[model samples]
Target: MSKADNMLSILWMLRSGKKMTAQQLADELEIHVRTVYRCIDSLCASGVPIIADSGPNGGFQILGTFADSPLMFDAEEQKALVHASVFAQEAGYPHTDALGRAVDKLKRYTNEKQLTQIERHSSGLSVLQPPIDPEQKGRLQCLEEAAGQRQTLRMVYGGSKGDPGTGSVREFDPYSIIHWKGQWYTTGYCHLRKDLRNFRVDRIVSLDVTDRRFERPENFSAKDVLLEQLLPDPAGDPSLVTVRIQAHDHVLNELKQHWLLGHALIERSPGEAVYRLDSTSLHSYVPYFLLPYGKALTIAEPESLVLRMAEVSRGIAEHYGSMLSGLPSE
Candidate 1:
């Protein structure tokens, strides 16, 4: 047997409470007695409590309490488990109540050393602020339940476009509730629009499960639909505007991860890269997403975005300048 298999077999024998000496274990496994002693040492190093005695009547034994313990995870596995649980709890994963209880139980089962490693690993992971609010949570739960039941739902949903404060109410057949981009959305068959629609759960003012039932399309796949919506058309209008920017590879790589960048390209240099951003709505993309990069970003393209960037910069400078003027300058 290989070294790992030998160690596993030795562990099994010790766990059985037979109290076999190293010589007896070597005889059973047809290996050197020295090899058996080394395997036992390996097991001990992995946190297994294997005890050995030197006297004539004495033999090898495992700690009685540890032998009966059902938990089998090693230190690293325990740490990984704790890290995953804490991440889920912080990320507003659905079924928060049940997950929270399960995580609490997991903490109870972990030892002090394992807990220390968990804390160390978790310190590097961070979930950004403004977690799901109560209204959004309740809406998500309602959508989840409705999707499972395949019940038609009535919702007052706003548009994803400009100033959608007061939206119209409509009936929809709930298909699925999706968690994407740190937001929860429900995709369903909209009776009002007579087509498929995706509604943001946070934007939904009210939701009601109707008594009417509707069958989801036989060949419908939520993943396929989402991919189609997310991935931009590569063969789309060849006349797509190319807006270049100068930024570090790290910043450029971060921008590439966005769903809207599917058709974009990045040309690399020594320490900087020029990004070719292609979007139908440059106005929205530039102000909301690109401007946040500040001075690291420079527009090298059609005069429109360059002017827009300058205009936005001036507006921000004026706004801050006005605020600064209200305070006494030193």
Candidate 2:
């Protein structure tokens, strides 16, 4: 194996539950015992926290609670980590801190040659530029503290319409802070309004933590509440709508692995398969699934979604026409 690959293998072995002696590693790598010692020293120097014990039963081991944890990565997880690291750096805050720490850990298990390769690959990656608002950062920090401590806060929040003249100052019992679609929102119980409300963190003009403590509802979960609010109801009906759609084999395989689709009924015919899903907002996701398949898949569903797709097609045609005429697409 290459030097870099050898180092990774050695780290993986050390991280495994089985303790390996220098002689064992040398035999496995087809190298001298001294070379194995040198490699171990290099790993330690790079902050791998490897421990060597001196006894008949003793051997080299990675000294950590996570030593036996699996290091194997499927292709997607590796790509995701690399991409997320780039994004964290560009975000210029907590993500940057996390990315730096992750890179440090990755470097410990890598040799100089592998480090060089990773640096070259990572240099080409970039993160999206985040909006610059120092005040928003401060408010986010305050919100984080309030959420962690379960404290009440008095703040002047700007209205959604962006009229500062109509902004209201009120007290709120912060339950949680959620990031949704690039915007930050703080969901809490408003003392002034006497109701549960979601406030945009960026709209917070002034904030002060209160000494009065509040209790979170025993049955209230942030994720449950968020999903309940997000999933749209068709018209005024709250009934779950089931829709069937044909999907490519690759897409079908991927969807099968998803726990959310466990309740879905699937049928196979010819080169494709159909999935029947019961969701309140089936119309929103049906187009998403169809986009990747193009004309390969058909939506065999509630007639409303079919009409929606037709309208979307008409809109796209109009957009293309306006683009060709050198007019605004909107």
Candidate 3:
């Protein structure tokens, strides 16, 4: 057996209602006595319930209370757990090593038939996700730990993806870390801004967990905070305007899934969607969002929005026209 399997086997041996010495465990598993001692220590470090009694009659055993407890997952439940682990990893879950160990333990305890079935299910399934950036991955792990342990973090925030590691430094108390779309975000209290804010983990140039501690607000919900930011209550902002659009039926499915327009949708029909958005965004983000649809989408109301789209089209044409002029005769 591999070292990991050896360790799991030792766990099983200890649960037989009989005290066992390290030498006996090593002999039974056909490994070294020292290996058994190391496995015991590793199990303890992993938070397994183990007791070491030191005396002539002393031996190591799992805590009596937990000794009889078995891994309760049946075949289908086991397959589901394996599949879920794959989904979690693909979503860039931090603490992947711990997750791997947990899954290994689950597989180690299952019988032969169940193990074969699990392998078959796992092989037939696959998941696709955006590639994880190493810097973002490290920051995500730190943010998650800081949130759980209530530790404040000092980080340099802001910068374009092409040129990171150059930004303003600030202290933040991470309340939550979440994965949305293909990006990672840490929502928290920013000491610099003196308000709650969310920062994309990828945009964080550098990060360090601080010794400072903080008490999270009572009944805090980071998800709710993020949702409100993405889809604000339009009534609260009197400057907002309603914009309506019509798209071909062939493209409506994808248009309905648009991040900003989809969330702001007030009403919809076969080829039309009405959305309420601040004029600033309507002039900026909305134009870029609908430009790709071209003729498939048509702006119907708010003449300013229609004019802005025309302006965007004109700018694109002028810029490309200049670039083509500079390129030597084709």
Badly placed stretches (over 4 Å) of model 3 are: 1-70, 159-166, 321-330
Best by lDDT: 3
Off by over 4 Å in 1: 1-82, 104-129, 159-165, 218-224, 234-239, 248-251, 257-259, 266-280, 292-295, 321-330
* lDDT: worst 10-residue window of model 2: 229-238
Worst 10 residues of 1 by lDDT: 270-279
User: Which window of 10 residues has the lowest lDDT sum in candidate 3?
Assistant: 106-115
lDDT of 2 by residue, 165-263 (tens): 477989998888776556677788888989888887777877888888888777766655654455333233446565655667676666555443433
lDDT of 1 by residue, 1-330 (tens): 888878877775666566889899898778999899889888899999888877987889889898655455665675676667666666565678987675554544454555566668767667664577887778777877888888888887874425344678899887887766777777878899898877777788787788998888888876666655554444463655666666677877776676665345545564444434445466656566777888776666767888877888899899999999999978
Backbone clashes (count) for model 3? 0
lDDT of each: 0.72, 0.68, 0.83
lDDT of 1 at 304: 83
**Comparing 1 and 2 on TM-score, the stronger one:** 1
- TM-score each candidate: 0.62, 0.48, 0.76
What's each prediction's clash count? 0, 0, 0
Say which prediction, candidate 2 or candidate 3, comes out ahead on TM-score: 3
